[model samples]
Target: MARVLMYTTAICPYCVNAKKLLAQKGVSVEEIRVDQNPQLRTEMMQKSGQRTVPQIWIGELHVGGFTDLWALDKQGKLDGLLQNN
Candidate 1:
């Protein structure tokens, strides 16, 4: 499986949903909590170009937030992304 990383906040529902979805896929996520640190939040925004709680990355691919991830899964493309780089 690909390495999954997510930039998230403590109380964001989207982050929770994203984690749950990834859990269902049996994929481990490296979560970075940006709620406590401004630098990490800046890094996430710079990397993803989005000021969102759940900024997701599958390997080197930026998969956006939970909605984007869900869309990918619905399209049946998420598994391939998880398995491939």
Candidate 2:
């Protein structure tokens, strides 16, 4: 199983949905609250190159935001990314 890391805020619906989807997949996520810690938001921007909540990472792979994640799942590529290669 791959480790999941999500940079989120307090009230992001996409974050909530992403978490729920991951939970359905039986994957535990490490939630980094950028709203509480401002530095983390900077780190998220640096890491993902995106200024958005729910910046998700599957191990070392940057999976972009919720829409990208959903696209991967729709394409049947998310499971392959979650598995250990």
Best lDDT among the predictions, by candidate number: 1
Point out where model 2 deviates above 4 Å: none
In terms of TM-score, which candidate is strongest?
1
Clashes per prediction? 0, 0
| Candidate 1 segments exceeding 4 Å error | none
Q: Rate the local accuracy (lDDT) of all candidates.
A: 0.96, 0.91
Look at candidate 1 and give me any clashing residue pairs. Answer: none
lDDT of 2 by residue, 1-85 (tens): 9999999998999999999888988899999999998899999999889989899999999998899888989999998888962
Question: For model 2, how big is the CA root-mean-square deviation?
Answer: 0.9
Clashes of 1: 0
- Which residue pairs clash within candidate 2? none
TM-score of 2: 0.96
Worst 10 residues of 2 by lDDT: 76-85
